[model samples]
Target: MLDREPYADLPDLPRFDLTSEDVTDGGPLARAQLSGIMGAGGDDVSPQLSWSGAPEGTKSYVVTVFDPDAPTPSGFWHWCLSNIPAGVTSLERGAASDPPAGAVRHRNDGGTDEYIGAAPPPGHGTHRYIVCVTAVDVEELEVGPDDSPATVNFQLFFHGLGRALLTGTHEEQ
Candidate 1:
């Protein structure tokens, strides 16, 4: 495993509010977001997300779904969406299956523009999915569709005005 900074240790500005009617923080993830692994039936749908209370100077938003407990040195990114209009504050469930207009879908850790959903390797234990909505200072991140999650994170880190997270957990049966 690779050594990396714990997410909480990162520099963060003031907090905002992010919520989801489909996902409960610290609660089980909805099956719709589960992956079809080990014969488990799943749709790999992104959960409905909503946010509010961004600080002044917010220009756009970035939304992502990351798995911190995956059996990986760098964790895993299930979603990496950039250039969401600042006027936009919510994403309907399954939106990842078909990205909304003006939403720039960046390459996730899975190397695709689609949400791969939760699919921990067998015996990998429970995993926490941290879904984040970042308020960015720029209306559009200077990035391409091929940009990796790490690249996007770097950009957001510096340009981020504030952020909010709606976390949920899941484990294989």
Candidate 2:
């Protein structure tokens, strides 16, 4: 596996506290977070996430799950939920199927607007799934269900006030 830090090139912004009940930084993801759709033999469920201490002026939030170690040039995006109201700080497991009102679930690299879970190719080594919660300055990100994860990130580059990250790793034999 290539040793790379995905966010190394991102603009340094204020950081907030992020926690997850079903995932942890530097830890292996549970089977529930593995991709059933991709034949990973696990339940495809979004992890429970919570965050706090967003910077002032934050009006909304964006949650994304990305894997920088995928065998693709641009990596892979497993989930991207945007335009969440700032008042909402936590999501229960499987929230991808029942996002908060006004939040838009953007299509991931898999062409689906929901969490796809992790399914690194067998023998590709461990992959890091980075879960990020970004505090935005607007109530809505102006992106729709048709927008791709890259598009949502483009908007976030301009409007993000702070961010929090939690990572989980997975590997196939």
Candidate 3:
């Protein structure tokens, strides 16, 4: 397994709260959190996530879930959601499976809008799911719904006013 940097350089910003009912920081993902491709009875679902304490200038938010240890140099993005209203601080489980009105869903590495639950190759060792919620200074970023997650990631470095992170891990035997 390769160890890769999770994110690029980000400006110093206020720390915020990011909690999950289905995932714990630095813990293994539940079977339910695994992709349906992993086994029976599983569906690709995003876990319930809640956040708070956005900076004063924040007008919107962006959420990204990435796997840095993937067998690739650029890593892999499982989910990318942009143009979220600042007032919205919580996402129900499976909410990301179908984005709500006004929310922009960018194409992840797998070329999907919905979350693709972790599926580290068998015996690839532990893979980290780094979930991030970024508070942005603008209500909407320049990136569009058809844009790639990497494009949104680039904009985040410039517009993000604050951010919070919650990481979970998964590995197949």
lDDT (Cα, tens digit) per residue for candidate 3, span 1-173 = 77765654567778899999988999988766778854523577888999988889999999988989888888888889999988899999987876656789887787778888888888889999999999999988998979988889789888989989999998888
Query: Which parts of model 3 are misplaced by more than 4 Å?
Result: 38-41
Winner by lDDT between candidate 2 and candidate 1? 2
| Model 3: lowest-lDDT 10 consecutive positions | 33-42
Model 3 TM-score on a 0 to 1 scale: 0.93
Model 2 bad stretches (over 4 Å): none
Preferred candidate (lDDT higher): 2 or 3: 2
Candidate 2 per-residue lDDT, tens place, 55-164, comes to: 99999999999999998888999999999999999999999999999899988887788899899999999999999999999999889999888889999889989989
Candidate 1 lDDT tens digits, 24-89:
998988888887632446778889998999989999988899988877778999999998998988
**Model 3 whole-model lDDT (C-alpha atoms):** 0.85
Ranking by lDDT: 2, 3, 1
Q: How accurate locally, in lDDT, is each candidate?
A: 0.82, 0.93, 0.85
How far in Å is the alpha carbon of 110 misplaced in model 1? 2.2
Model 2 lDDT on a 0 to 1 scale = 0.93
Give me the displacement of residue 70 in model 3, in angstroms.
Answer: 0.4
State in Å the error of residue 56, model 3. 0.8
lDDT of 1 at 32: 88
